[model samples]
Target: MSRSTPRPEPFVSATSAAALNDLRTRLRATRWPDSPADAGWSLGVDVGYLHELVDYWADEFDWAAQESALSRHPRFRVEIGDLNIHFVHARAVSPVGPALPLVLSHGWPDSFWRYSKVVSLLTDPGAHGADPADAFDVIVPDMPGYGYSDRPTGPPLNSIDVAGLWAELMRILGYSRYGAAGGDIGSAVSRYLALDNPESVVAVHRMDAGLPVFTGDRADLSPQEQEFLDSSAAWGSTEGAYAAMHRTKPQTAAVGLTDSPAGLAAWIVEKLRGWTDCDGVIERSFSKDEILTNITLYWLTGTIGSSMRMYNANGSIPSEQHARRVEVPSGFSFFSGDLFARPPRAWLDRVANVVRIKELPRGGHFAPFVEPELYAQELRDFFRPYRKALG
Candidate 1:
């Protein structure tokens, strides 16, 4: 913990054999529901679909594959402010030049696994086309109370607090100057990183620049923005039930997620089903093992409770921070497939430098895993100019 800026420790623990056992038992005891005969995903997380998923998770799922992959990265923890962060510091493939340090953060329901594809691609961009000088020493941290950082303490942590932790983590990793990128909740935290440590964050990138952090009222909205705003409002009302629960009664719902493996699958599978490029069952997009492994991390680490703390924290965007213009150099990837892909140029312009924007023919919110090649290329291309600037 930084003596100057000590917060409280959130994620800390020795992984228990008992926790893993409890998860398996929960999976074994899952009481399944029956599906409507003609029903499709319209009902969300189809019942029959879930049964097939649960069986595979119970029998064939390889949790070790993901666990070992994550373990090989020299995982370590640091007491920063109040959070004990779990992170992987993978060195860049630049034998000659400055290894551009980069912290790739993930959003809700996604562990560091979301950025797994981009890590090697960014750190070894010479293989992809960009110069080695542009390569970044990637530090992908499981945000406090999220993945492995489960044992949170104190009131609740907010985006700015997370941003501060990122700053401290970057410094702890000896990254005085580094680039940052994220999507979903990751995007919000990255924005705060830029906002909090404008001097330290050399460049900031986000998948959802259209969330309109500080943009003003409806009077400030144009006709086009007005329509998008209306659609956003509708989506907020209908699709944001998950956010509502997290914001208000996270502890209440953490009960089921912390208990049942199948229950956690139902929660996360809904996102993979609802948010990914796949139109039908999750298998169409992700293997049952992949889906199960991600959820299992939450179960094994008991992160469900701490991760939900994000909801209770950070009430609404701060008045000054909201609609507040970001001065740092910024870039945006218009992964229009994601939940927050707002395309209005004005909406995006408010918070980003936006040197490059691409409209992918395919992909969705989980673009890193959903469309690795395209997403990797987007990262390489957007940071190309900065690579040149660096040299």
Candidate 2:
């Protein structure tokens, strides 16, 4: 079979002046929600803190600077199947050996912006004092319906469908074989890429093992594994409410999120603070500009609704995909501050061909962006052994 050549076109994100003005107006006119006496983040986003953030977003945050910085990367759009995928195709600048191609997928509440911190570090390791041989030609894509990519107007696309698109994307980019890495929903996408196209994906690395992929009898799992499952359920009871809303009633929530910048920030920033190792201070993990930049992307692109719809699509993935064991070599990194507890080796072994597992001293769910140096080094070490396969 002949591979299709991709017609790549340069892509840049530019929010209209009117849109910026409207966002400011909405932020200024935000309907304030009253907080219970002494209420902090326990009852969702703290109204006090949110008001402060809204003030910064309205009067001080710089969207144009962030947009310009984002456009500095070599971004491009390529048509694949029914969607036009937007991706950053950065090549190794001073290679010492093979510049292995690596595709990185981003999760929700984020776009390709999730990988902006680590792209250059991975692509040119020598500049960062690492072995130039560790360099990778990084490819970070904004999955369909997120960021600059076309949103699904028909049936929502799941991780499986996006994985298929990613496989074809790599093929179209002239990579017959490559490595895959990601976190959050991205972790699931990388797993699906390995499951659905193992021949082409040499190895895969993820921050989380994703929703537990199990098969056979429950009797097979160790007691600790069972406890982990129980803890997951408990976590879901509290942390999972938003997911349920996304799965069942995204449109209801999307209406407010899409219409009001403050509403969107309130929804997304809570997760950012809760899921990160910020010790209850969001500014510890992200600057006001950084936080607002991400929120503003959702606001400007009008993608909050489409992004939420992905949960509905994911909920419908066939049981067989959940049960399918990933045969490709897999690696896992458990960042200490991540929202979900790290799965035991026994649990991960049930789903993937586990080759490496490491627990970092710091970082949380958004590790790639929060701790790019550590995250990039982890990728370099894990994929080091697989580089020969690309030869």
Candidate 3:
């Protein structure tokens, strides 16, 4: 590694035998809740489904295999400021041209696991029957208080702060310039990275435009944009309760989530099912192993509370950030099954110098994981024009 690139210590994800035993013990001891005779998922996580999942987790799901699978990638840890961030850094094997350095940020209730499926596809597109010129030196980092990264002991770090850390991380990796991409909270972080460091970020791509960043005159919005905002409000009225809890009373809610492994699964699996193209069945998008692996990471790391507390920190971002327009080149992919309605291209143009926008026929919020090939293709195509700068 170059002297400018901080030496990344090799890391592995390991769960002790005792920890596994304890988890099984917890599962065995779980006191399942009752539901009405016909209650399916309308109330929340279907009780019958939860029972089936919990049984699989306790009896069939293999943590050892999942851990080994995650460790198959070159995982590393480096201290960025006060937090020791964990990330997967996979370099292109063979490139038809210069491999663009790309950083992928993940959203809530997930970690680097969100990008694990796409890392190799991004790094070696030729193996997947695409042009080797599309390869990227992919870096997928676990945000502070998420995954194996250090949880905040003090005030939580907001998206802008996290964006600054990401910029520094790319610099530490010996890349003075790079592309950024993500969805959900990661979308917000990528937006800030473009806004705060337009000079260094070659371009940015996101699955969503993020919360309305425009605070300007209402007259600027097209009728479609107005309708989108109105529908967003309507969606929030029903589907936004979890965010409100995260923003306001995360600690109180964390107590139960931390104590009950099943409770943790209940909270997260609902989002996975609701936000994906999985219809009402989560397994359509994520296997039992995949779901358990994610939930287990949170359970073993004991970072769910710290992760939720980030919402509290985000609520205090300066109003200017919301008002600022991102000058860096931007791309967006609106997957049809996503929970949030696709924003009109007019609305996206309002906040970003959008160079590309595509509405995919399928996929959802967790596109990288659920639709890795399509997601990787979007990144490769969107960032192709900017690869010359990295040379």
Off by over 4 Å in 3: 1-6, 213-217
Error of 1 at 197 (Å): 1.5
Task: For candidate 1, give the lDDT of residue 253.
Answer: 85
For every model shown, what is its TM-score relative to the native structure?
0.90, 0.98, 0.97
Give me the displacement of residue 229 in model 2, in angstroms.
0.6
Candidate 2 structure quality by residue, lDDT tens digits, 1-391: 2545668788987778898898889889988978898898989999889999999999998888999999767999998877899999999988988899999999978999888999999999999999999999999999888999999889889999999999998888889889999899999999999998989999999999775645557788898898888788788897999999999999999999998888999999999999999888989988888888888888898999999999999998877878777899999999978888678878888888999999998889888999999999999999999999988
TM-score ranking, best first:
2, 3, 1
User: How does residue 274 of candidate 3 score in lDDT?
Assistant: 91
The TM-score, computed over Cα atoms with residue i paired to residue i, of candidate 2 is: 0.98
| Predicted candidate 3 versus true structure: per-residue lDDT over 1-391, tens digit per residue | 6665566788987789999999999998999888999888898888898889999999999999999999878999998777899999999979877889999999998999999899999999999999899999999999999999999899999999999999988888888889999999999999999999988999999999775644667787899998888888888889889999999999999999999999999999989999998777788899998999999999999989999999999988888878788899999999978988778888887788999999998788898999999999999889999999886
lDDT, candidate 1, 1-391, per-residue tens:
3456443233323555676566667678898877788786676667777878888777777676667665655466667765567777778776346666778878888778787666777777788776666677778898888777646678778888888888988877666777888888888888889878887887888777644433467787677777777777788787788878888889888998887777887888888777776755567767777777778888777788778778778665567775666677788776645776465877667555556666776678888877777777776666655543344
Candidate 1: C-alpha RMSD after superposition: 3.2
Candidate 2 regions exceeding 4 Å error are: 1-4, 213-216
Clashes (backbone N, CA, C under 3 Å), per candidate, total: 12, 0, 0
Q: What TM-score does prediction 3 earn?
A: 0.97
Off by over 4 Å in 1: 1-18, 127-130, 213-215, 388-391
lDDT of 3: 0.90
C-alpha lDDT of candidate 1 relative to the true structure: 0.73
